[model samples]
Target: MNEDPGRDVEQEEEELFEHYRFKVDPGQELVRIDKYLIDRLPNTSRNKIQSAARNGSVVVNGKSVKSNYKVKPKDEVAIVLPYPVREIELIPQNIPLDIIYEDDQLIVINKPADMVVHPGYGNYTGTLVNALVYHFDNLPERKSDYYGRPGLVHRLDKHTTGIMVVAKTEDALTNLAKQFYDRTTERRYHALVWGDVEEDMRIEGNLGRSFQNRKVMTVFPEGDHGKHAVTHVKVLKRFGLVTLVECKLETGRTHQIRTHLKWKGHPLFHDLEYGGDRIVRGTTHDKYKQFIHNCFELIPGQALHAKSLGFQHPKTHEWMQFDSELPQGFQELLNKWERYVTE
Candidate 1:
């Protein structure tokens, strides 16, 4: 597909929210939308549905409706709600933060490598959320206090280093969440991949968790499954066996950049989960193999960095952009490649 950096904002908005659509049966009796939805959506509460209705996320026949709106027979009903929060207790930990900018409404930070964004099954502490809760008091949560994630508008991979924005107030959280759902935020990543990508290109496909491997993501080109994703790539430099490229995300899906680049035959270097750990290109000579092995040791994981981010300020409505430098290991890896190519 031809590269179109701009994506359909409405489609992306639907993707961002947990969207549900239902058609009333011809013999169905009239019922309140909130009550109707709660019956159909398992583990959902009336309060959550009512909140969605107040936010203009509930609709009947393509028109926004209130929670009390009656669902009539033969009517098409749709609603978009924020994802449900996992009930996990948050424990604050005093982790040093690399603060880029901070205001009453929000904070921008440069996240380092090897830090998980939030607590999960295998990871329960030493996360960005833990650090955030310890450093910033009263950060707004998107859903309920049960939600361990506070002020997290977006996230990066555990091994990915980059810039991220966190909201500080409820108003700021709502506004910034809407901005992300509308696909107005700008995100750029720098990646070193294992191939000679000659020109700029766009990768379009559906991305979902692999059926065989739940921990990893895979691309579904047939469009039969998964969420739509798009990544625009521009070649920055080539070192014969590998190349450095900048990736701009049009649609953010889990592992979008890594999966898309892998589908294009250029997986990020040292990406163990996606088949980039071993040599995918270049000579198999013992000397060259040794050089590649040493290069892999330079970075903790994949050679990818979220170098830039841009969005409108939630409170001021003014556009703001932030950029971050590559980590020392990533830079040193590049230097080694440069020297190897010149020799």
Candidate 2:
């Protein structure tokens, strides 16, 4: 139940989008309004959240307020989110899409490195979802504000390039997302990391948020909020200082492969976030921007590539797979590394 102590119910529903009602507890005290919005709506972007609060969509104790407004415990707040339509009208443009495989139910796309899977803060216009919006005749209803991102079952690092699957229908979305939850979907990444891995090493660790930064994930011993993560590393080739390795994902945690590799002392080169920059650039340093890219070379971003994807077809129950070759950029770096090792 919620407080309808003051305003009209129908008008309120039409006026504000926060249909998910909430009451502030006395224990959860004195936090900023924008942050409260985040806690309330996990799917909405921070930028949209701030704007909604500023525009007076947020009411504390039945009073409109700004994003920076702070509140004490036991505050009563009402929030409204933008109306969610069953189907949103998204204009499709003729953007380049790397089609790995396609069927009636799903599409396997070799997402480029620089391309975003969905839209959010600092990224709105140019995203995989935006392209997909135009690619499909209709998109299914979004579950949350992250709705801007449609039919996306998994995500690659903004810098890490790899294979991604886009669902064409609601049924496909359900089947694919469930596959990930059940750990049935198979994903593999090719990382040209710096330094040699210690002979086909298997590094397994629990992952959770970093203590120093809330924005980054870190490896930790068994503890609160930590999820069990398993990654398999196989040495593909050794290049003196750098080694090209293939990573297999058992559990898809945020940045699981990258974070695990970094923890295992064989960080991918040019990885500024989790220890990739430490690798010594042998000779050719000025050739590429970042070292991660998507599965195929169709996009731009990082040196990590999604080389392959395997899954049981949701509808057909047939075993299917898609393989993407390393982008020329990644190959070029490997060549230079090989040359450096030779000379």
Candidate 3:
């Protein structure tokens, strides 16, 4: 499995409701499943395991089991549970949000680039969550089993600009979270990548953090490691050496699009982590190199935008879709590319 840099297994698992599997040792003695799990799973409490078992979330040998069930030798055990919560003081900051739509149930915002979605280790202030708590009251905070991100059902990377939907009430939070987890929500991203992608294609692979570089994700084509992820790419426009494509996610793993596209021989322009910051498909001329450098300077990070989002409204059950214009920097970069191609 891929590991997020600077985060432990528990933290990573808790970021989303995750499925965990364990194999009882052949030489192991009989023990209550909940107690056994409490020992094996770090930071997870006995009450949480028991609750999951009572809810039929714990399974052994293909059948659901109660917390009192004794785990047998060579038993295949699996459980579904949300990540444990970390106690951190959430300080609300008076940061302005670009609200796209808001109602009693939810709020949608056009997130700007370079803004971290939530506060974490090195990012303790100026986060979208900080802004959220300041601007909105009674926002549903994720349960202890889920990540501690208030009102957030999903997230975007710090440098990735896009649209995000925030839940205002618990019902809305649960419903929206379920939609995202079930892959029922629609999310489309526009990305500028190095290389001229010849045709539309689907990229399927297992994504995991690289052992060599803990901060960057890598594709495991053999499926031997990591979580399964899929991204569909459709060419929108081409700029000789680089291409703009629409990426539709079939599964939303961490850094899924960036990792998948990199594995497919196309990295987003100026994506420093994925090697797109350097010239990968361009000429050796000094003038071309300088032009590429100038282009990179226009964006804070990778040339990717979360342009559209669609989901069912929890309160009304109505299908809702929202589209966002590209950020000014991204638009200007595209304009520069167009001008270069035309000239």
Candidate 4:
């Protein structure tokens, strides 16, 4: 139940060499490592979970096991958690980042749908952190110790592409984070959801972790530990049961728009971890390796885009705004399948 503690709890950020230990609850038995840890490890993608499990970083019942290993109740789970780190030498390889705007205070990048912004349970490499590591000489390897995250002011869902601001400096990071935390940040997204939904509507609810699954969030009538989130939606396209909607946020919370839409009975397509798993089972051209492209046009991931971001420049002390168009794939899919709504 223990490993190296010298650097595990140290002030180091990018300790790609340090490992961690995870214990499994024997009460929750008979589940695959990747499947089980994917839910248990919040902020980590399933693909990375599989990779970690395969690499022997994940243990089951105190024994190294494959990602597909099944756990029995009372099995002590252990994980040699990888430290969040960039390769320490990777140059920012000109990966075609869509920069909307940049200033002394902060920078905005149009994050792709599949882009992971920071370090998490299974994601140890190839992320915005890696990119920033190469782009900026000193972007702060780890913003916090316990989480081992970056200075990302906010995050878009890995599958939900769009605009997000990155703070290159500590003061800017704190200011931007406070704006979001104080509910003063203005953000919006283009979301193509299943089912025709109302236009220009406000959704208010107390969001909390789902009792059914810790991996998902839900809207509840009664108060929970979750924060209050407010979202406004306006319809852009309609296809009988599904519709393209634009959402603006008054309060930024984890998966606020996505979780809220799903709670309202209109989950985004391709959101496997959420209620969107049903889309993969669709009849036509459905089913792909762990995903489905079901956008009225075309999307390899969910049809949510972080289109616009508005916030006061932390350093400049002036209001700044940025916007990003949909990625080519999302736009192309929208053009092609815009009418395929035979439903």
Candidate 5:
């Protein structure tokens, strides 16, 4: 749990909204919301449209309306929901991977920092998904319920290094997704954050994209915006100006730990997105500044690592857990801090 966590819970590459807005033509006839959407949104199923309306993800004039609601002439309609992925030509690349566990149903990889999980608009190649494609031919194919992403049911940030699981079959994909959706899977992270966090803390907040900056996520205390998120933090070590802490995710939200810790005034060390890149503590002397700068160079991104993951097997129903060694940069950075504190 890097102290200053940022971003929303739904920032996955495949979890983006398929947004549509329309003004009913003046001569249009009255039609059901689902029908109206189906006529306009190509390749969308009636069931998909109805499900969106049922979940209040579809709205008319800023108010959530049901599927049965009849559309009138000149009525404004807006739809914002996760749309099925459009199939794209996926090119496989023979990139190396750190495989920790592999079987017929699933494969666990200790993903390195700075690797994008899947390809998107700007990122087309050199991703974990590409490597998986080259390495495994029988990886589960995408269904209509989701956008075209192979094998992966969840994602990690481009800079977040940690353990991740990929499904090899459709059964494994569905089961893994359900486990994550039900919050039954266990995820633990290690983060080095600014400030001396002397004790354990639990935080609950509604997380959504920032109003000021759409690129980042923010917590909504009123619970009116975004989705509910929870995180538990326990202090593992204290180094006066910084602290090493362990985080247990109660809810998997994009940048939940980073944003929550930022809300608590302790952003992760060198986290560029959450204001951790600056010196938030310690003496302002030149020598101290140099030391901090050197530390920053050791770990260029946020000091966050997904240390452990636990979940039940899809076929066998047996519980499985895996732990990963910290990346070289993170370990060396911690050692430097330890030596500095002692000296």
Candidate 6:
């Protein structure tokens, strides 16, 4: 039950590194380290492996090595590099963006649901990055020349709506990144959960990729696995069957709010990944079931929104805050619930 002081939260704006390890066979012949990795790491090229070496990411037998260094028998090779398995070309597409604020150093956006933040795996296009590429003419070019991502200081889930910031300059990027890393930024989410929440509460746990489902996160109550996460919640309104709540994140782990709320026994309404799509509470009458089903249909996914954000201006060092209204569907769903409870 002990908690580590260090928390693990994945900000979408931050670059994620993929970790790799390889142990050379005892009888393996010496060969160029770069060539050795090219055969082992799928889709990676010689140039990319060499670049990783130059960045001190590639190690052999516990020491960083040059790409041309010989791989000896029993050598243990490891690397940590930005993910995507391979480079991808970023194409600027003329997608619409709901821009909230913009300056020479950064841009703020009120993102909509159903838009992936950046491209990866099956989602290589139609993301916020593609739209950003088309929208902004002067994005800061990364020093590492990493492909396909830009300007992002943090990200929202594809199905989650809310405010986000993007950096426009290298200095802005660095300083903004530091702010997020130091946990100085403020983020608030509005979530409609399946059951009435009577009291305000704080939830804490270690969050990690679910061992049973790699696609989603799970809570490790013992704090022995995953990264530490904390969320504070206040009930905003109460329907006998459901509750509207505001969640403030202390750590932004991937799916932190969703998973922690699930562990707290109040998974968000219509949260398909965490089994909130079903009638977790309320009357078992067919009418009630049908009404719940209809509510689920109104919102495309989980009824959660990143309603507000606060952070220091990366350049001016001024305190900046922004808020967004709930999306149309979320408002409509809540209205329906209010009517249901009153009637």
Residue by residue across 1-343, what tens digits does model 1's lDDT show?
1212232211222243466789999998889999899999866778767766765667799888989998899999987655443456878998999999987778899999888887766777998888988876554533332223465667788888999898765456555665676678999999999989989998999998789986688999999999888899999999998999999999878888889999999999999889999999988899999999999989989999999999999657899999999999999999999999999
**Candidate 2: tens digits of C-alpha lDDT, residues 64-125:** 78888897787877765453322334446557788788766788888776666655555556
Select the stronger candidate by TM-score from 2 and 5: 5
lDDT per residue for candidate 4 within 1-343, as digits (tens), equals 2233322111111122223345656577577767877676545567555545654456665566877888676666655433333323433433456777765556688887676776444654566766765655444443331122335656666777888787654455545554665456677888777776865688899776678876667788566566677789898888655677889887766678888888788888656666664552334543432223344335556778888888877756788877778888777656644545542
List residue ranges in candidate 1 displaced over 4 A: 1-16, 20-80, 138-149
Q: For residues 217-273, what per-residue lDDT tens digits would candidate 5 score against the true structure?
A: 899999999888999999998989999999999988788889999999999999999
Per-candidate TM vs. native? 0.80, 0.66, 0.78, 0.64, 0.75, 0.74
Q: Which candidate is the best by TM-score?
A: 1
Q: lDDT, candidate 6, residue 218?
A: 93
List candidate 5 segments past 4 Å from native. 1-83, 138-149
Which wins on lDDT, candidate 4 or candidate 5? Answer: 5
Residues 1-343, model 3: lDDT tens digits: 3334557321221255556799999999999898899998866778767756754568899998989999999999998665333455778898889999987778899999888877778888988888987876444543333323465667788889999998765456556655676688999999999999999999999988899987788999999998888899999999998899999988888888888898889999999789989999878999999999899999989999999999999768899999999999999999999999999
**Between candidates 5 and 6, which one is better according to lDDT?**
5
RMSD of 1: 6.6
Question: Each candidate: what lDDT?
Answer: 0.81, 0.65, 0.81, 0.62, 0.80, 0.78
Q: After superposition, how far is residue 57 of candidate 6 from its true place, in Å?
A: 20
Candidate 6 regions exceeding 4 Å error are 1-86, 138-149
Cα RMSD for candidates in order: 6.6, 13.4, 5.5, 15.6, 8.1, 8.6
Worst 10 residues of 3 by lDDT: 8-17
